[model samples]
Target: MSIAGLLIRRERLARAWSQEGLCRGICGTSYLSKIEQGKAAASEEVLALLFARLGLSWTDDADGALHAQTEACMEALFGGDAPAFAAAFARLRAQERTLLCSPCAADYLLLREFACEADGERRPLDAEFVSFLDQRQLALQRVLEGRHEEAALLYPAAAIRLWQGAHLYARGRYAAATEALRAAYDAAAAEGYAHIMMNCRVYLGNCCSDSGDPKRMQQHYAVAQRLAEALGDQKILSTIRYNDAATKIECGDFAAAYAYFSALEETDAMSLHKLAVCCEALGRRDEALTALARAEAMLPEGEAHAPERQMLALVRCRLETPDYLHDERYGTLLTDCFALLRRERGAGYARFHLKWMLKWYKANRRYREACALLEDFPAEK
Candidate 1:
């Protein structure tokens, strides 16, 4: 069946509507059946009328208010536009709450979950939401298994996989995240879904960086960079550059890393924090201090004090003071930072910072503290 036919059937079933219920004032049951079966086409006017009766839209045009708004919100979220993402998410929440059968229900919830995480307010997933997403994933898997001609109907599967990857990646399940993103990449690439494919590739590259496979990491990054460059998407290009620089640091290419991080226009905590690392590597201690100061100034206090911001403070202390580790304030700061990382920053970042802490403590002959830390947070999982 055609993708539209599948959508109509799926939506109708979701609403518990029989063909008769849907065709009562639109078309005869026979014609509706033919349309659903893809044996006949529905005229634009008729399709719109049918969908309107079902409280759905057949068109994705700007005139279709819901679809347009959803698309705009998703775009804003992908672009990292905080205000726009928040606004869009608020509206989506209202819509999905009102209509559980909303056509883009899964999409809305997935984006909302990601936004919440990004905002540092990650909530536990609801049982109902998990059940709903599981159903959709199963349905998509069935379609894929059958090799249906309307495989495009399973396009949401790619999105589902992408978010799943993001969740795993945030939790430091780098290998699992790679698998999910790779699945998403394969599906999106098959459909020529450039935006989705590019995003999946970018994240796949990120997972590889943490996976400790330098060749694979750089290979994925190279592919993502090429695609972003070909698309002339400056935002994604910048993202690639940022990630590439971080990967370079992991690989001990400090000078090249400094060049990449220093060339970025972004002055946010994340960029500044990473740039500080690059600066420290190049022995530009003054510049590193400046970057950390700027990063610290940009962060708020209390619950809003992000893990990265805490890490930046620790880095600054390390650079400016020789006996920093022995200082109670700095020691407390490192302990608090490690706690934050373990609680909110995910496994990969937590492990990274913990190693640094251990190295610092051991190097400074703080053997007791180092041994205590190792006992408290054992690294061998």
Candidate 2:
């Protein structure tokens, strides 16, 4: 069926209207069905009347430039270049009327939904409309929801595999995540998908870092850094810098890590939080508390920020109770931290927190608590 016809049918079905109801006083039910089924061509007048009745819009004239610009917008979105995507989306919005009437209408709607999500303003896709989406789009939606397993099952597309690798990395499955990411990188390279390749390299670098292969991690980061520079994506470049500093923290190079984190522009809550971590490690207790407070202030009130809130609490406990082993509040914070860690689907942040907790328990001769913590989240085999 024609894309327009499919969109009409999907929208009509979403509204729970039957063909007869949709075509009443406009066209015969069979004729409408024929148009929907692509059994007959729809005339301009008939299509216009049908669209008007359904509160939709359509035009037979397709603008090639608009189509190209839409593709560019999607590229920016996928590349994780927020500024680029914002500028491109604004241009697309300026042509909204033409875009909605052109053949690119359905894709534009889907793109807008993705843009909304990227901006942290989620607008759930309609069930009927979602059903009409291609497998890749459905997989992307699932990935956005943190339903990575479901996303992995949708298709073996390169982008889907990239997300699969990322999810695996988060879950502490380093070897598997590395393998998946490498395969995805190869596929993306062959397909000339620069954005996917860059992302794959970034995740692969993370996997290497978490797996204790610092040299490999740096190599991957270097490649990703080059790609990010080539793409002119400052966001991903900053991310690479952050990850590199975090790896230094893992290596106990707190002084150098602190310098790096301090130099970074505190553009988000997590950046400030990372700064707090470095300060705490450097024995600058007061500075750490200030950064932590700033981080907490930036967080929004929602379940979505639950993990971040718990993390901030854990850090605050560390700062406030230097003698935590002898402090009653330590036990409560420890329990809460562990509970949140257990619920974590990824091991990235959890791994660091767990390490700190284990070290604290061991230094204070709390072997029993250490053993219990190990039992809850055993090290990767």
Candidate 3:
């Protein structure tokens, strides 16, 4: 440990202090432990008190604690040396802590990010909206730093449930995701946090789709679409529409599924995939390939890559149409499928889907391919 770290520790111990002792009015013992162990950083107010508790001069600018964080936030809102609007908005948020619960916190966060983005106003919107966004920025900081649980502050109701469900889904815990998302939906139904509710519903639909619970997926999309319509949120409505398209495709409503996606201004990945699936269902092999290509193009690069893209790649390789042929292009599709099958990390429908694919190949007189797939599949217990 550095001398400063050692001094802090010695002074704390000399006072017969526990990590919990330092956290009395500020945070939790576990929180303090992480800080003292260098796994976390202490807030300025806590550090000021720590010095005072050690009978030392408390001569420090308290904002000094969050100074770097504020600077980084500004940089995020304004990267260039140009004037930063986010700084002013951030200052307002910091100065008026009461702004935390304001209705426009969302707008403030948007502005703050925009300030970094454009280094100027991006759009002509209302002042109330900006103020609300400022509060949201502060809330995000607290949440990211693990202070949400400490302060008992919550996310925007819709975002809260959406994130909770998303987190559970990432952990392969679908049941928990369903419960969290449903709570969020229910809460929104009463109070109308429409945009957030739509996001939550989007995530809920995704979970249900993977679980093969198409009914829940359809229901979520319906409710989300209704909420989006009420809010006049076209973007989210597009998402819900695309999800509904996927559900339609699953229900074997190929014509309706195609029409649904064709109507959307901005179709999502699942929509593209579903559109492709519709083409396959209609025996339009060329169109199906194009839709699959479109879906692949829509897959975001790097870590944000959607898992469904992998699944779709798998389908392209193994899923056969009498109209389709085995060639180098088909080989690429097969390779993509194998990669997807190898990386099927989630439970429930993943293995089941692969099993069904294998069965489909065999039933179609593709014995060689079925044997090849069986070679890679886990031996049945």
Candidate 4:
């Protein structure tokens, strides 16, 4: 059925009006019924009249202005101008009925979904709207759902390879992610899509960081920072700063990393956890415990946080005990940490933790446990 017809019928029913009452001065009841059933299309004049009688606005885009605005909306989205996109979207939403009944309804729906995602809102798509999504959008939906392998199969075009790289990164496949992100970066550069180029650079930086290539990581982050600054996107800039601090930690610059992490305005659970790590590294045991406590309080009690809780427990064990190296609870927590890291398939994190675990095993003369841990998690190529 036509969207207008469906909306008209729904609105009529909502107002408890019969077909005869709705079409009394607009058209014959049978004609109105046919239109509502999708067997006939109403003339523009009749459509305008029926909507006016029902106290709804009807716009047929006679001047092509609405179509131009639709294109502008998409351009803003692709250009990463969140403010511009928000304004354009507001204008389009004000003409919601007209846009939904227009030929560009699919585009409208796609824009709406992207907007919702940017706002961190997750809701099921309408069946009809889902049918309108192309491979890229479908792949993005899969990526958001953590189905990286399935999403990879759907991203054949270079334009959407960024999403493929992002999903692969989420799966801890740094090598594959770097390759995909580099290709995506070239494509974005060719297309002059600054937003996409910035995102590709950020992911490339992360891949390099995970692979222990600090030089290349810094280079990518430099480009990303420049692009983010040019685009005026504070969110991406904040992400770059957070990642830079993490790389500092990997480089053993605990004081610098601590200062950087401490300056960030974000107090989310993950950020607090990172702050705790920095504090511990700097030997600020009291401050570290405080940060850890705040982080633990922010986490909800559930299986969803089981792995994170396990990691936090290890940190706390190290903090609360003077002889954590000889503590049985520390050994148990480390064992659980390894198990959860394996289950989560976080190769990057596992590699980092494995180094510390091996050092502990060797110092304690636990050669067998070290060998078993190495066997379970081979070094990444």
Pick by TM-score: which candidate is best? Answer: 2
All models, RMSD in angstroms: 9.7, 3.9, 12.8, 5.3
Error of 2 at 375 (Å): 6.5
Q: Which residue pairs show collisions in model 2?
A: 170-346, 170-347
Steric clash pairs (candidate 1)? none
**Deviation (Å) of 80 in candidate 1:** 13
The weakest ten consecutive residues by lDDT in model 1 span: 143-152
What 10-residue stretch in candidate 4 is worst by lDDT?
119-128
lDDT of 4 at 378: 47
- Supply candidate 4's per-residue lDDT for 345: 46
lDDT of each: 0.69, 0.77, 0.56, 0.76
TM-score of 4: 0.71
Candidate 4 backbone clash number: 0
Alpha-carbon TM-score of each model against the true structure: 0.61, 0.80, 0.48, 0.71
Off by over 4 Å in 3: 1-161, 170-172, 186-194, 205-216, 263-270, 292-381
What's the lDDT for residue 256 in model 2? Answer: 88
Please give, for residues 311-337, the per-residue lDDT of candidate 2 as tens digits. Answer: 888788888886876675776777676
- Per residue, candidate 1 scores C-alpha lDDT tens digits across 1-381 of 233455577679899999999889889999988777767777777877887887876553335666677777866654434466788778877776432333454455456655664434544343333333444433333332332223324444565566567666766667677777888788777766566677878888777776666677678878888877887767787888777777777677889888877887666887888789888778899999998888888888876566777789888877987777667778788878887887877766665566577876876788898888666444222
Whose TM-score is higher: candidate 3's or candidate 4's?
4
Question: How good is model 2 by TM-score?
Answer: 0.80
Off by over 4 Å in 1: 1-156, 325-329, 364-381
lDDT of 3 by residue, 163-236 (tens): 45655665456777778777766776676545556667777887776566788778877877787687677767
**Candidate 2: residue 254 Cα off by (Å):** 1.8
